[model samples]
Target chain A: MTVIALDVGGTSMKAALVPAPAEPGAGGEDVLASESWPTDRTDPVGGILDFAAHMAARAKALGRPARAAGIAIPGIVDEASGTAVHAANLNWRDVPMLHLAEERLGIPVAVGHDVRTGGLAEAVLGAGRDAGDFVFVAIGTGIAAALILGGGTYPGVSGWSGEVGHIVVRPGGEDCACGNRGCLETYASAASIARRYTALAAVPAGHSTPNGSVNVRAEDVIARAGTDETAARVWSEALDCLADSLAATTLLLDPGLFVLGGGLAQAGPALLEPLEARLAERLLFRPAPPLAVTRLGDRAAVHGAAILASRLL
Target chain B: MTVIALDVGGTSMKAALVPAPAEPGAGGEDVLASESWPTDRTDPVGGILDFAAHMAARAKALGRPARAAGIAIPGIVDEASGTAVHAANLNWRDVPMLHLAEERLGIPVAVGHDVRTGGLAEAVLGAGRDAGDFVFVAIGTGIAAALILGGGTYPGVSGWSGEVGHIVVRPGGEDCACGNRGCLETYASAASIARRYTALAAVPAGHSTPNGSVNVRAEDVIARAGTDETAARVWSEALDCLADSLAATTLLLDPGLFVLGGGLAQAGPALLEPLEARLAERLLFRPAPPLAVTRLGDRAAVHGAAILASRLL
Candidate 1:
């Protein structure tokens, strides 16, 4: 059997045609075909339909027609109902994702929340493969987490679990887009870190420290944190907020391991060392879980989508 | 076969003999014998051994030979190792409870953490019996929660998953015993509520609202919340903090039901009504999980110990 997987993001979609596992307990299927498309932004649903149809056609031409497909997308998704409740960035709501995909491609389609799909992938094949229970946190433009239990995603009753970014780590510190004050995302997200750093330090015109930034990126700030005073303060604050949030996450779930994904994790030891120290110090009694960087990187969700599609077989 | 159950606490110990089910898939085990003894604060370990010996003898005298036993205690416990890691109130550390109990009682003894056991009871037979994926929080002197996953306790890798009390509801608000500021316990636990109210309110010359206290108890403060200004402020603050913590809990775990246990839950609607309201108000997009009061009350842990003993069968 063949399956098609699509990871729909805010800017683009990564779609792949992967053959289902040949045997019940075998290794992964080889990617029979794959493609990437810029999301319509104005008409994401239509773009998804067109791309999926094209993938199905390509799979058929390659003599490996996909029997089913799975999609992972941003925003509130009702996986059980296969509906996209809302996608603020896409300006879409109540788009029956499963129906539209199945109708367009003539195959069963599974829809899942993006972070959760990434979490599932990590739990089964990435950083948390050996860990019993773990929280997979992605800290990029935003910070969110997926609680992986028994080697699968434990999406909440209302399917709103893992909104760690919105949790009030700072209480009344700063205004959050969610109408809250001092949320973890407001202080710790890569975007927030860059924004805060930009507000504090003026980037020199000749500044060049690897990954060039138009202004000053989170990476640029973190790179200069060792020597620059302003960068040090901003970077330290972000780490403190992240450590504080992780502390709360530990207290609530007591996950065996915390798998840090997304762009911020690229800082590697710089992020992990301080975070590990803060979490261990804060959690005085029990041992803090090991924090690891994601191995699958950005492709984690796409692989997870294929895994989800394979389950449909 | 018969099994002994013991719930060791800071103030007292509740012990009982739970008979093995006569037939498979039965409702519950019959209580063959029961007893309670005031715990010796100075010699908690000795008190526990004496109480367990007495309970085992009582069970044997009643024509029921005990084959196994289960003990629950207040502290940082490693259930797998049968070790009570730490109990500050009891001034104990690294006590190999399982080994000592088996040596003295001549039976297989299962040692479980007190709050986790209470959460087990609530999940299997009390307020949380019907709720799916619930969190059982005991709000006495300090607040702690247990994640009841798949009808069992989700003890973390190091057996310390449910320390929700330490989650900072207000950063830098009040110093917590765990060396943190603005922990959930500092604002929402029964002890905290009463302490804060005492500092803020003047009790009436003649005031009695069940659970009696000379100055003011949590119950008294809650009882006067509707009429007294100071009581109202304190009560509201506590509820708000609780609401905030629960919101974070909901976001992280997405529990179907929240089983509120411990002393303050005795306030019933006074606590639940405001909490439910606040949680619902704060969670604008998602529906709030129903918060229910624990039915077994103080006996919840003892019953859980009995249940654990039965599992030994």
Candidate 2:
């Protein structure tokens, strides 16, 4: 089966022509032709549809003859209804994305939350293969998660499920973009850590470190862990916050495995080792599950979209 | 067809002979026989077996020829393995509950977590009949929850799921019996509310009320909400904490309804109304599900056990 897959991101959109059954591991051979495009968020809805049409057209030009297309977007999406309910970053609400794409591309379209689509990919063809129950937590600019249970990605009834980022971790420690105080995202997310380190660098000498001295991004802070005291402190606190939230999730869900994804997961052992140790400490009697970085990396959503599209075909 | 149902609690045990195909929404009728006994915590493993034997003897004496037995118990129980993994309150670990019951009763036995079994009763026969996805949250001395998805209770992989009370809501607020700081149980449980109120009463002149001196239990706190400022403050905070956790749950697993049970749920509209409003505020764009009190009250677990027993028969 051949299908067109489009993964919409904040800065870029990836499009792919994939053939199934996709290979069952990282760096597999099932993926055929793939390409990328810069995403323009000026007119987010138009940008999304145009990108989908462009991907479909490219596949057609290549004689792939794609029967269906899948688009994965970042935000709350109602997969059952084929609607993008809300995307704060994209400034979209209630966009009938599937219907629009179907009309323009003249093919069946499967619309899904980006993280859920990525999780679907992992569950079916990557790290979570053969696992009946698992949580796919993607840590990017902000944190979110997808739950795969009994062979499907469970989109909570309201299409707002898997927003693990907003779970309160500190209660009253820091204000979040969500208007809540001390949400998990305010501490553990890449964006949050960067913001925290930047703020700390601004403090006057003899007191706390000044935010101006840091001028470091999330990756820069992560790189300085061994040499920079400030970076190590910020990173340590971030890990602690994440471990706290994951422990809470473990207590409630008792998932067999946790597949970590998104940009921050590239830190690999730096992120996993301490997280595993801390989760073990916090859990009362439940055994902690194995935690691993997603095998698909940045392409997970596109791969997952391909899987969904193939199913439609 | 008739079967035996046993509900084991920390302090007492209740057993009933239930007719098969139990009536919907009401406690089953034609209870051929019923018995009660004190739950002996010392040597809890032996006590559980003894309790099952007593119920079996009573059933046999009634001459109903009960065909199967269902038992429900608190704590982390592995229903599939018929073992009570851990019950901190009961001080039992890996108790082979099913084998003991089967040996004593000489009948097929079904075992399950108490709250989850109660949720099964509601999902199949009570207030949750219409909800495809819902959570059954029972707030007693400690709080726990059961997830009902796709017409069944999700026991999770390790059978240690649904420990919702341990989800960190206060982060670093109060010490929990689980040795964690600021678990949700520290603020929203029936025990916590009473404790908070008692702490307020211990304060000196600063605690004196405009109307009169006040001392309140959890039940009294509910009653004094309209007139007493202290009671209202504590009650409202409890409601807020509950809403925060429920909102997080919704974000992760968007259930269609929340069925509240146990002692605290007796507060009814006072709890439901505020919880609904607060949850709505936390939700970004999705619609909030209806919140209702469980119709079965304290008897839900026993009824659920009866349903499971009937299935076995």
Candidate 3:
């Protein structure tokens, strides 16, 4: 079956006319046609409607009927209402995403929270395939988790579930964009680690960046962490914060398996080993579950969108 | 139809033969025969066997047959195996509860974790009836929570879902019997509150106990919180710890309502109002869910057991 799957990220959109609804465990989808577009800072809904129409027309040209379209976007989403409740990246609010796409492309549509869509892909086809119940935590510029129960995302009462980044890991530590102090994102998010590293590096060498810009990305800091003391401290603190939140998550949901995705998850052993050790020290009577990295990486979201589109079948 | 139901606690067991498969909103059970007994710390499984037999015999004498039985117990339980897995209070390790009860009573048996059972009752028939997804936190001698999803207990993976009390709230504050330092139970449980109040009151002014035995209870400290600085601090800290833990839970589960039960929940407004306020301040973009004290009280578990028994029909 052919369907359209779009993962609308902060800076770019992963758009594809993908083959889906094949055997569940069958490897990857055949992307009949795919495109990446710089996300419009304005009119996020219009951008999607236009892209979806284009994909459907392209599919028809290839003698494939677009059965349905599935879209994933950043921020709070109410899938039941098919509304993008709020998205900082796209600068949209309550945009009727499903209706807009269906009206434009003349096909059924599915929309969901981005991270949860990613988690769905991971739970069914990627790292969490063995975890009937698991947590897929994505630690990119922000941190959010998808509670995968029976290989599906658990949409909360209003679809605002999996806001793990805002969890107050540190009671009175750093200010977060979410208007809270000590949110997990403030300490452990890729964006936060880079900022922390920049501030720490600034003190010892007095502006490590000759260009007077904070050029320290999380990947850059992670690269230097093994060799530099400041980077090590910054990296360790991020792991501690991540582990603390994961411990709390393990105690509550007890999914028993954790799939790490997003940008920081690329750190691999540097993040996983300490995180596992820290989680083990706190689990008490409960046994520690294994942690695995995402097999689909950034494409997890697109694959999850394909899965959502398949549900229309 | 009638079925046997039992809620086995550390101190006591509430047993009853309740009517089965009635209308959804009906209140209370017929209680064909009900009994309470001191839980035998030694031979915990044996005690349950005896109780189930007695209840079955009583129901038969009343001209009602018990078709099935449901039991809820404190500690980790593998409901699928009917094993009461490792309860600290009972000093129990892998006690085969279901087969033993069924063998003794000649009925099908269903077993579940206690807090989850109570939460099931609350989610379906009590304060949390309005919530499709809710968190029921019971703060008694020790703390535990039940995650009610889609109006039922979400048994995580190996049935260890909702072990919220050991989430490492204080990091390094006090020692816990769970071999961990600063668990949520160590700081905010009714037992912890009473102990902290007694220790704080026993300072400097010395014979601050006046009664000489330091016999202060959580209720007394809560009652005197307004007038006593030490009591106020103790009460405030408990509320803060509970709020912190609840906040973490909200971040993970995003339940629409929080039903607070157990002994400390009896504090009512003094606990709920402050907890709601604290949770509100920390939740940031996420709306603070209403905090509700459990209406079913301690009877929630027994009622839940009845519900579980009814599932057999």
Candidate 4:
């Protein structure tokens, strides 16, 4: 069995130990002792209980001693009282966090909601495994979603379902550090497309471009938007506010698929071919739901926190 | 046992018979016989198999004969292939409707989707009985929603889950008849607040108002929005486009309640007290879900088609 996962975020955490899935719903696992680090930005729950006591002493030196532990945090989680009610980049709040990760790893923990345990590990082991209802999104440095439905992870009613980057896709434009305004994470977040292409134009905040990169980041403003015109107008207004928040999540959850995942989906195909042609031209009468990418990349919330600690064993 | 139920609606139809819920899940039923009319809208599937063959001859003259039915309809339904695929106000297409209501009421049917079967009779018998995640909406003459969740009726991955009146809350402003522009049913439907207060007031298309009411409906533009000024600027831009589509459905489905059924929720408290204070001033950070209004009003899709024909027995 073995369990212990972690995740955390606002600047890294990961952890691991995994094992579990020998065939229940079977979304496979394995890890058996992984790690990572960096989160402490002022004690992210004591760097997630010191990385769950170093993955419960690396699952007791591989004798499979980890029984249960999940975690997966990041903003406004409440996964049925496991707490961590607000993260705001880990300034956190209400942190019961499954009773502080079961008093720092005594096991039986569970806690989810890091983009719904990375959309339940991309709805069971990556890119909404043949979709039983989709929408995973992520797009890092702020932007969220998860819905996943039948394959699990709805989370609404107080656990605050998905928060698709604070919805209002430009309704008075800009200003949202969640205090809201044009929020689609204030023009599509990968830190708002490298801060709206470094506040419009002459790059220079460690600028280098022409693909040699330097810092301009949202994958260097999508690899200098093919010969930069202010990085193709801030990556085409961040794919037009992520195609108006996926055309309001395809008219409020018609999800069949839309996986995506963090760190601006590593700008693959410059972010899914202009976000699948601007979410199929803002879904005129509905039909746009095929946008994959994220087959466990960024280890999908530490393999959905080891499938929520193997469903608490 | 008895079942039947119907709904239909492009213009009307209600039907009924009901009974079936003495205990299991207990959301009570008991109708026995009922009716309503007006929707032959160009043979809406032969007026729903002649109103399910006159409600199966009034449930065999009230001796309680109905075995199973359900129906519901309205636009784009596929409810797991009960199929009435498109309704565009009953100019239907791809009809199947539970195989023509089990070949005209010979029994077991079930098709749904009229706003998720009035959000499953407001998540089981009205105003979302104690919320299992809410959001029913309805808002007649166009405007939809319904996504109950845990208590059922999510219908996403296809039956186009809750098209919150085509989301784009004023992204391009006005227009919409689904050709989209600023949807939220082009400024909150109830026929878009009496067609935007009769295209910005002169009101004389049978105008009366001052509560003396006559034609300008939407509850006479909310009883002339307390002394007109173009009915308080089209009912405060239809309560700020239904509070920006319920603050983008409270940040993408944090729904725990928001009931408000059709016919502009009969403008009760002038549409739920300024739409619960403009959905609590456009949810500047959550908490806003309590809206309420539909305690089986407009018979919540004929009692959610008698709880989807008592779950087909």
Expressed as tens digits, the lDDT of each residue in A132-199 for candidate 2 is: 79999999888999999998998877777788898877766788888877788898888888888777
Worst 10 residues of 4 chain B by lDDT: B21-30
How close is chain A of candidate 3 to the true chain A, as a TM-score?
Answer: 0.94
Candidate lDDT values, in order: 0.83, 0.82, 0.83, 0.79
Q: Report the C-alpha lDDT of model 4 over B150-250, residue by residue, as the tens digit.
A: 78887777788788888887777878877868878887788778877876765556767555656777777777688868888888888888888887887
TM-score of chain A of 4: 0.36
Can you write out model 2's per-residue Cα lDDT over B193-299, one digit (the tens) per residue? Answer: 97887677554333555456454458877888898777789889899889978877787787899999989989899899989999998775567778999987877
Which regions of candidate 1 fall more than 4 Å away from where they truly are?
A22-33, A198-216, A224-230, B19-33, B199-215, B226-230
User: In order, what are the TM-scores of chain A for the candidates?
Assistant: 0.93, 0.92, 0.94, 0.36
| Residue pairs clashing, model 1 | none
TM-score of chain B of 2: 0.92
DockQ of 3: 0.76
Clashes within 3 Å, all models in order: 0, 5, 0, 0
Candidate order by DockQ, highest to lowest?
3, 2, 1, 4
- DockQ for model 1 equals 0.63
Predicted model with the maximum TM-score? 3
The native-contact fractions of the candidates, in order shown, are 0.75, 0.76, 0.78, 0.85
Categorize the docking of model 1.
medium
TM value for model 1: 0.90
- A202-249 in candidate 3: lDDT tens per residue? 733345574444467888788788888988999888988888888888
Write candidate 1's Cα lDDT for B104-139 as tens digits: 999888999888999998877788886778999899
